[model samples]
Target: MNTGKVTLLSAGPGDLDLLTIRAAKALAAADVVLLDDLANPGIVSLAPRARVIRVGKRGGCKSTPQAFIQRLMQRYASKGLHVVRVKGGDALLFGRAGEELAALRRAAIPVEIVNGISSGFAAAASLGVSLTHREHCQGVTFITAHLQDHGEPDWAALAATGTTLAIYMGMSRIESICAGLMTTLPASTAAAVVQWAGTADERRLVTTLGRLADEANAAGLGSPAVILVGNAIGEAEAFTVRGFGRAASEGLAHAA
Candidate 1:
């Protein structure tokens, strides 16, 4: 008997509109779905016939263990039931997808990955700014603030050299990230926090490297945010004519 396969789908943050048709179909056809908190539960509602399980891992909060989630995915797929692992944002970006992929590969379970709109790009889009402005910057690099030990990101490379930095899952360590970026980035560099990008509640706080930490913290931005640092983000003010980044200038945008 052939066991069912597992689809590792990127749910693209909290917005259901960002989901791809392939992912939507997988969810609808799934017999079992493992969902993370970042994903809108309404997306799972499409797969009403499937058993839904929550295995979310929120920062500083008690939640399901990673190992347990991996085991459950394997177990359910082994039973010949289509398993869908719905994660918020692009699963490959800071989502620990490599670990899960390895476990499934070792277990001989077929695994397919579906990419979604990443929070970094979405945040940039929401701000109506270009992360890779040819005049200000030519390269856009994505990096996590830390692994687990709170060690610094690859500051020496991206910062020392020239590249736009789009940090993911860095809200919890905005202070640390700010300090590190200051080491190489100019103090006057433009920076911003796009909280809950791609949603109606999207909020954007544009400031400089010298005050990004204070501004983002004071605004009380929460997790699931993306921080864009570099001169490329400087264009946010001009982009707001299209209603993009209106939150910063209009005051209607609260810290989401």
Candidate 2:
């Protein structure tokens, strides 16, 4: 019997237009598609003839177990059915692609990865700021607020690096994260949060490291938002029309 193949695809920050050609092709040819909560529902239309299954994993909500998702992929591939595992943002970045890849390999299954735009980039674009500016930051760091082992990340060391930080799954722990970074980074370091990035409903707030948590809470920002911190962010008044003190309703417009 011929073994089916598996494709790990990135859905790209909740926007259908952000999907890559390769990702779209894979979706169109999939025999079965397993989609995450972050993926846009419109993507399902790409694989009209395939079995589309919702296997989303969201924080503080009922999520599909990782083990079960892996097993389902393995089973489907063994049955000679092409499986597409769709995740939001880049599949390899905080999407748990490692576990699924390892499991498929152990099961002797064929698997391929198709990359897509990450939320960090989208967030940066929405704020009209570059994560890496030669005068400000030399590099960028992508970190998750949710720890797999439930242990705290070394925020002080990360802050010392002086790289721009793009924090994911951080809304719930915003206060602590801001406090931790304050230990090493200055209280005046620029910070911003982009919620629902790359879409029509996107919202953004710019503030200092010391006020990020408070401003985010005041704006009612929650999970599924990307938190950016670094001097590279500068000030909101410089880019957004709403000036520095208030949250902007739309984040993509550039200031002339």
Candidate 3:
């Protein structure tokens, strides 16, 4: 019997056009496709004849068990079928690709990874700001608010790093995260939340670290949003403010 292979493909922030050529090829050739809830539904169309399985795992919602997903992949690949595991954003970043990789390896299956643009980058792009602006931040850090142990993250250490922070799955704990960061980062530190980044329903809120939770709540931003914190955010916020001011001034001038 011929051995099968598995490809972990990143769907690239819910936009099919953002998919890499290699990722598209893998999907087109797949015999089985394991889809995630956050992934763009259009990706499934690429796997015309493949058996598409929805194994969505969303926070605070009923989700497919990780073990079951791993077993399904292993079972399909062992039967000489090309399996494509479609994940939103970059598959390796907080997507549990490590667990699936381990399972496939233990089953003696061939596995390949296709990288895609992470939501962190997408969120930043949507705001027209660079997370690593030379005068603002030297680097960027991507961390998840949700940990497997449900324990707290080292907010103090993270704040002390002075790197731009792109926090995922943090909407539910925005208040706690903000409070924790305040211990190290200044209350005036700039922050922003970009919800549904890269999609048509995108929304954003810009405010100070001290007011991020309240501002986000007032704006009704929730999960599937990226929380950005650091001086880098100031650049975008400033631009937005200037644009708003200019528009208001033009309206008054026209009225006069």
Prediction 3 global C-alpha lDDT: 0.86
lDDT by residue (tens digit), candidate 1, 130-169? 7899999779999887567967676657787678888887
Candidate 1 residue-pair clash tally: 1
Per-residue C-alpha lDDT of model 2 across residues 132-240, encoded as one tens digit per residue: 9878989999999899897778999999999999999899999999999999999999988888888766778778899889988987888789999998887444766
Better of 1 and 2 by lDDT: 2
Q: Highest lDDT, which number?
A: 2
Q: Evaluate model 1: give its TM-score.
A: 0.93
* TM per candidate: 0.93, 0.93, 0.93
lDDT of 3 by residue, 67-170 (tens): 99999999898889999999999999998999999988888899999999888898777666889999987899999999999997999999999999999999
For model 2, the stretches where C-alpha displacement exceeds 4 angstroms are 1-3, 241-256
Runs in model 3 lying further than 4 Å from the true structure? 241-256
Give the alpha-carbon lDDT of every model.
Answer: 0.84, 0.87, 0.86
Which of candidates 2 and 3 is the stronger one according to lDDT? 2
